[model samples]
Each structure stands twice: as structure tokens, then as C-alpha cells.
Target: MKALISNKVFRIVAFADLLQQSAIWIRNISLLFYVMEQTNGDPVAVSLLNVLEYTPIFLFSFIGGAFADRWNPKRTMITGDLLSAISIGVILLFVLAGSWQAVFAATVVSAIVSQFSQPSSAVMFKRHVPGELLAPAISISQGIMSLFIIVGPVVGTLIYSTLGLVYSLAAMIGLFLAAVLVQLTLPPSPRPPERRAVPILEDVKAGFRYIRGKRNLIVIAITFACIGLGSGLIQPLDIFIVTERLQLHKESVQWFHALSGAGMLVGGAAAAFLGQKLNPRVVIFVGIAFLSCSIIVEALSVWVYLTAAMRFSVGVMTAFMQIVLGAIMMKLVEEAYIGRVNGAITPLLMAGTLAGTAMAGPLMKTFTLVPVYGMSATIILIAAFASLSMKLGGNAANTERSAVHLD
Candidate 1:
């Protein structure tokens, strides 16, 4: 991990990512609490927030990927941070004016810009990181993200509760500006070579065709989509679980996120240590299976401490799954196609997320939290079993070796 961090580019990008993720989580948590307060804990409003947050991915990720391939990644990242800062600045104005509705618009705009920024970030990893160190790099990155996940909610809630919405928005604006400054330190990344003139839609279609031809990529993408669905179903319900089921105040919700983040920290450390030794396929399968079981236990248990422990366990397994799957995808695709391949898979994942969020309100209204959690667990379990058939683990080491050789 130290060796990977020693690389100047990786260090810069990782730090920038940490700040960016922190800003995102802080904004999300604050907005969620604010909305809950305004709507008097209406489930429908919460679900709508989730939808608005993720809908831009469905709408623009493919176009973002196409452009990421065409543009210099460094410039793309800088521009994204700039745009995000401006958007937050606008929101700050609205908040100062006492208009809360603008917060939702800010969320949508942030998500849209993220579609471009995320692919560019991915491209940067592919461009700068050595193939041999990729897994560890990703693990290290995830570890930092987990750290933010632990702290961001607590900090966000504190700021929102004490300083109020305007101050929180100002903090977010500052974070985005910091990210942009850090991004400027990165060396310029190469742009893809010009090809014979072709329509952008055709380029996107070709990307899909490329993925469709690869069965392993298809299986992995589908499994991830399922995981996204399960995640979506449960994510919006966490607040309800704490406030309604556990009989805790809304402010106490950060404890659950903090505990989960603690687990992620542990899981990420383990992945960084063992990522190269572990079979990627097996890691993903076992992670999902354990996560499924944990979700089930969490759903059935009403005790706050016990449920918190289960949520922690879920976080650990989730870290393992995410780190391993990311490494596998990076190894599987050629650098040139990384953007498009990621673009192709994002919608399937976001579609599942959108569907689950759309269903969460009605499901909770009709049946309550247990059934919703139960449904999430069941879907994740199915995804776990289905992972057994994937060829991800087989020849993974050899593939890495080949990738290094190609580089």
C-alpha cells in the first residue's frame, strides 16, 4: 500500500477522490435529514430523493463515457469539479434565500456531472496505475472512501443540526473547490486517437456490442445489477429502521452509518492485504453470500445493537465485493474500452437501483420494513448463487500477467 501511494499521480488522484466523496456523502446525508424534517418523515419523499439522485446516471452515463474516451481525463476531471462547485454555489444562494426545493435540483445536477467525472476517474486509474498494483490501489482507494463514509455522516449531521443548511452548503462548496485544486496537480492524461468519423451513438452501440460479445463481462454486469437492486431497496429504508423500528431519534442515524463505515475500514484493509492472493470470483461470491445472510439477520432482529452489528457485517462484505469486482473488471477490459464498458454496465445497475427505490415506498407502506429487507436479502442470495457460474476467478492471475505484458 505504501509503495502504491508513493506514486505521485495515484496519491493526488486518491486524495482528490477522498475529498470529492466526502463532499458527496455530507451533502447527501444533510439533504436527506432536511427533507425528512420538512416532509415529516414521509417515505415517498425519501424514495423520490433516491430516484432524483440516481436518475442522471440512467440518462447520461453512456454519453459521459463516450466523451471521457474522447477527452483528456485530467481536463475532464477538473471541469467536473469546477461545474460541481458552481452548482453547489448556486444551491448555496438558494439555501440563503430559504428555498429548500433547490436542494433537489442541485442533487440532480451533481449526479449528471458525476456521470462524466466517474468515468474520467476510472480512466485515470487505468492510465496511471501499474497493472500489478491495481488491486491494492483500488483497495487503498476504497479504504479512504470507507473512512469518509464513517466520518461524513457524523460531520454532516452535526453541521446540519448545529450550523444549519446554509453553512452545510458552504462546506460542500469549499470541498468541491479543494477537489478541483487537487485535481490540477495531476499530470495531463492522453486523449484517445482520432478515428474515422463516426456518429457518437454508433460509438456507444459499438461499446455495447463489445460487451455483449464477452460472456464473462455480461455475467459480472448482471450480477452487479442484482446487487444494486438489493442495495437500493434497503438504502432508503435505513432511516426508517433507526427511527421507527429501533425507536431512535433521527440524529442517531449517523451511528448506524458510522458503524458500517468501521466495518468497511476493516474489510478494505483485509482486501488490500489479500487482494492479490484471493481468487476474485470466489471473493465476490463469498462476500455476496455473507452479505445476504447478514441482511436477513438484520431484517429479523429489532434490537438496535444487534442490527448495528449486522449492518457492520454488511459493510465489510460489501467492501470485499466492491474491491474485488472492480479489480476484476479493470483486468478484464482493455484500457481503451474501459470508459465505454463502464458506461454500458452503469445503466443496468442504475436501472435496478431506480426500480428498487421506486418500489421501496409502496412496499414499506403496504407491508413495512421486514418484507422490504427480506426481499433485498432474497435477491442478493440469488445473485450470490448465480455468481458461482462466472469465470472471473479462473485464470485471474494469468490474466493479470497477460495484462501487464500487454501494458
Candidate 2:
């Protein structure tokens, strides 16, 4: 652990990533508040905002991955920050100019720019960290990221509701700017780009070919995709339980979210500590299993405190699964094609997110939070079953992994 956190370059890089992940929450919570304000707190509008934020995965992630492979991760990360900052800046100005749609479009563009950096950023951790420490380190990073997401919305909303939207967004822009500056001081990471490139169709084909041929990768990828669909329901769950199910006071909702943040902080720390001693695959299954059960517990409509407990549990589960899968992916791929691997899998995962969010909005509107939680539970169980059948029995992994993206 000392070695993991001690290196100067790794520390700087990880801090920058922490800031980067924070920006996601800052932007998301800000947008959620902005759209809710504009639409009179319509959940559909909020869900649409969620869609806008993720639309890039459907549109540009694979290309982003390929670009990461073609360029230095540091430069690419800086570029992502610059583009997102510009988009956010313009949107803030647009909001000042009385155009909410322009602000929405700007957020969408920011999402697009961020997607490009993700593949590069995903690959960079491996470049900087030693092999043995990757799992725990990634757990820490994911935990920190989840912590920000938990805070960003609650904080962003308080500030926006009090200080107004412009000031809140201004704060976000400053953070992104700071992240870019931090990224600049990192060590140079250069990978060889193909001097002669394949056609776009062929490049995409190659990525898909890799996904199709690798059963474990497919199992993991599809599992997340399914989980994403269920988890995506979260966009509306906050509002739904706050208003419809629990009929809780607004302050209670805020407090629940705060509790979730606290849970994420603790859960992430626990995963980081326990991860090194555990099988990455089993740790992932445990997290998912726990997460599914949490969601199912949520569906029972017991009470607000109970629901909060479930979400807290979900926070822990989400952090564990996220950290474990990331570690597994890093182990599974070649150093050369990590970018491509990220690019390929992201869209499928995004599709799940899209499907989940979209599905949740309609379900919550028509059915209730119970069904939404049920769906979340069902998807996770499926992932667990898939893990079992793939011969991992929820714990199968080759300690000696190769880039098995071939037939």
C-alpha cells in the first residue's frame, strides 16, 4: 500500500483522476438541479438530462478508445478537460443569456469530450501502478469517485438553490481547470500508434471481434451492461422515493443521500483493504450479490430509513464491484490494447445505462419503486448466474492472464 500511494507520479495522476471523477458528480448534480428547476421538477426531464450526459458512450466511446491508443494518455486527458471545460463554460454563459436548452446541449457536449478521455484515463492506471497493487488502488480510486458523486449532487443542489446556478457551475469549471493543470505535471506516457491505420469499419470490427471471442470478457461486459440498466434507475429513484413512496420530507431525502455518501466512503475503504487478500472475481460477485439484495430490500417499501439502509448497502456493493471489475479488466488486457478494450466495452455498458435509465423512468411513473428495485435485483442475479456458469462459480479467473482477445 505504501508503494501504491507513495510514488510521486502515481500520486499526482491519481489525485488528478480523483478530481476528474469529482467533476462528473459536480456536473451531474448541477445539471440535475438545473433541469429540475427548469421543468418544475419533472422526473422525466431529469431522466432526459441523464440520457444527455451518457449519450456519448453510444456515439463516440470506441473512437475515443482508439484515439487513446493513438495518443499519450496525459495529452488525451488534458484535451478532455479542455473540451469539457469549454462546453461547460459556454453553457454557463448560455444560462446567463436565458437559454436552458443551450446549457443542456453544452452538458451533452461535455459528456462527449469526457468519453474520449475515459479510455486513455482507464489505461493510464496500469501504466503508472505496479501489477500487484492495481486492485486495491483502483478500489480506492472508485471509492473516492463514488464519494464525490454522493457529495456533488447534494452539495451542488444546496449551492445552486442558495447561491444560484451560475455560481455553482462556475465552481465546477474551476475544478476542471485545476484538474487540467494537475494532469500537465504527470510523467509522459507514449504508446506507438499505427503509422498506417485501418479503415473505421475495420477498426470497429476488430474491437467487436475481440469481444465476441473472449468468453470471460463477454461475461463480465454483458453482466455490467445488465447491471447498468438496473442501476440506471437511480436517476429517478431519489426523486421517486422522496416524493411518491416514502412521502418523506425533502430534508429526509437529502439526509438519505448524505447517508449514502457516508456509506460509499466507508465501503470503498473496506474494499481497498480487503481486496488484496481476496480473489478479484469472488470479490466482484460478493459486491454484486450484496448490491442486488440491497435493491430487493429497497423494493419492499418498508420505510425511509430502511430504504436508506438499502442504498447504503448498495453503495458498498457498487464500489466493490466497480473496483474489482476494473482490476480484472486491467489484468485481462495487453498494455498495448487497454485503450481499445475500454472503448469496446464502454458502449455496451452505456447501452445498459441508457436502457436502465429509460426503463426506470417509465417504470417508476407507471408501476412504483418496488418494480424498479425488482428490476435492479433481477439484473444482478442474472450477472451472478452468468458468473457461476462461466465456471468462475463466482470466483473463476486465471491467475496468469493473457490478452485473450483472439479466437
Candidate 3:
């Protein structure tokens, strides 16, 4: 942990992530509030915002990843941030012109830019951070994210309420610019030495083959898919849980989210402490299983406190499991392919989330919240079982790599 703290690259990247996440939250919350004001709290307009935020991942992640692999990591990341800033500027102009609908463009452009920048960040970790310290680095990263999960809404609301949408957008622009400057301090990243001079479409095809041929990667893909599906099912229904199940106002859902974020903050610390000492398969299996159980309990519980406890536990386990998985991916994938692997894996999760989210409304309409939540829990448990099937001979470094014909 000490070593991770002292690592210059890690410090720079973590700070940059901090800036970017702050910007994202400001944009997310302020825009949501702005849209609600403009549309008089229309649910469809709000839902459209969610779709804009997520659909970019499904549409652009793979291509952005391939580009990340093709470009220098530092350069790719900087370009992404710069483009995001520019797009936000454009959106600000349109807003000033009274084109309120252009606010959706802010969500779309940033989300698309993230699909590129995010994978490059992983490649930076793989290249710059030492293998032994990777877990702690990721733990710190997730911890920062969890912290935002707790505080972001409040911050965004404060800014929007006080300064209105214009200044809120300005704040986002400033944050992105700050992130770009921090990232510029990073040591120049050299492109991977094993680069193939193939067309991107061919490289993407190679990425698919790479995942297909590796047993562990295959299992990881399945696990991601399941997590996405299960998460998607319940994400849209949390409000319903508060209103119908717990007999509380819909606004009370914030407490559950806050509790979950608090749990993640603590869980990140614990996962960092455990590090490689915890067996990957067992830890993940337990994490997902616990998450499944928590959902089931949340579904069945009429008591508000019990439901909040489950929500907190879900956050803790999510942070723990995700940090471990991230470290494993960094160690397991070759630096050359990290971007592509990430790009490939992220879309699957996003696709599943979208699928589940789409299904959640209809499913709830049919059977109500409890049974729908139960089905989501059942799907997550299946993911836990899937994790057990991963065959890790030892460490991620020792995992077998798949031979691909990039030619």
C-alpha cells in the first residue's frame, strides 16, 4: 500500500480519475435536474437521459478500445478528455441559444468519450504500476469512486441549485480541463511493441478470438454478463422498493444508495488489506453469493432497516468483488491487449444492464417488485456458480494465454 501511494504514475492517474469523476457527477446530476425542470419531471425524458448515458458504451466501447490499443495510452486519454471538454462547450452554447434539448448531447458525448478514455486508463495501470501494487491501486481507485457515489449527488445538487445549469456546466468543463492537465504530467506512454499493422476491424476480430480461446477469459465474460443482467433488473426498481415494499416515500431511496456507497467505501479498504491473500475464485464466489442473498433479503423485507442493511451489504460486496476482478484482469491480460479486452468486456456488461433495465419495467408490471427482485437474485447466484468454474492454476501471471492469428 505504501509503495502504491508513492508510485508517481498511480498518484497522477488517481488524481485524474478524481477530477473526471467529479466532472461526471456534476454533469449527471445537474443535467437530470435541468431536464426535470424543462420537462416538468417527465419520466420518459429522465429515462432518455439514462439511455443516452449507457447506450454509448454498447455502441462505441469496442471501437474505442481498438483505437486505444492503436494509439499511445497517454495520447488517447488526453484526446478523450479534450474532446469531452469541447463537446461540453458546444452543449453550453446550444443551451445559451435556448436549445434545451442539447443537454442530452452533453450526456451522449461524454459517455462516448469515456468508452475510449477508460480502457486507456487500464493500459496505463498495466504499463506503469507494478504487479504487486496493482490491487491496492485499484482499491484506491474504487474507493474514490465509492466516495463519489456517496457525495456526488449532494455536490451536484448544491451546485445546480445555487448556480443554476450554466455554472454547473462550467464546473464540469473546468473539472475536465483539470483532469487533462493532471494526465499530461504522466510519463509519455509508448505504444505496445507487439503491435500488428492490421485494420481495426481485423484487430477487433482478433480480440473476440482471444477471449474465446482462453478458458478463464471465457468464464470472466460469462460472469460479467450475469452481473450485468442481474444488476440491470434491480437498478430501475430501487425506487419501487422504497415506495411499495418499505412503505416509504420514493425520495427515501437516496438513503439506501448512501448506505450502499458507505459500505463500498469500507469494503474497498478491506479488499485492499486482503489483496492477493484472498483466493480469487473463492472471494468472488462469496462476494456474488452474498450479493445474491442480500438482494433476496431486500426483496422480502418489509422492515426498512433490514432492507437498508442489505443495500449496504450489497455495496460492500460489490466493491470487494470488483476490485479483485480488476486486479486480476490487469495481471492476467497482456499489456498489449488490455484495452481490447476491457472494451470487449465492458460492452457485454452494458448490454446486459440495458437488457435487464428494459425487462425490469415489464417484469415489475407483470409480477410486482418482490418476485422480480427474486429473479434478479437468482440470476446473480448463477453468476456466483459461474465464478467457481474459473480455473486459475496460481496467480494471474501464471494464467495461460490464448494464441491468436492476428494475421
Q: In candidate 2, which residue pairs get closer than 3 Å at backbone N, Cα or C atoms, i.e. clash?
A: 229-356, 392-395, 392-396
Global lDDT of each candidate: 0.83, 0.73, 0.88
Model 3, 120: alpha-carbon shift in Å? Answer: 0.4
What count of clashes does model 3 give?
A: 0
Of the two candidates 1 and 3, the one with more favorable lDDT, higher being better, is 3
Give per-residue CA lDDT, model 3, range 87-169, as digits (tens). 99999999999999999999999989998899988888888899988898899899999999999999999999999999999
Ranking by lDDT: 3, 1, 2
**Regions of model 3 farther than 4 Å from truth:** 395-407
What global local distance difference test value does model 1 have?
0.83
TM-score order, best first, reads: 3, 1, 2
Tens-digit per-residue lDDT, 71-172, candidate 1: 788999999989999998988888678887888887898999988888888889999998888888888888888998878777777888897777888888
Using Cα atoms with residue i matched to residue i, what is each candidate's TM-score against the true structure?
0.87, 0.86, 0.97
Off by over 4 Å in 1: 30-48, 94-100, 236-253, 302-305, 361-372, 393-407
Q: What is the per-residue lDDT of model 2 for residues 58-101, given as tens digits with 9 covering 90 to 100? A: 78888777667667888888988887777788888888898877
Each model's RMSD to truth, in Å? 3.6, 3.4, 1.5
Sequence-dependent TM-score of model 3: 0.97
- Root-mean-square deviation of candidate 1: 3.6
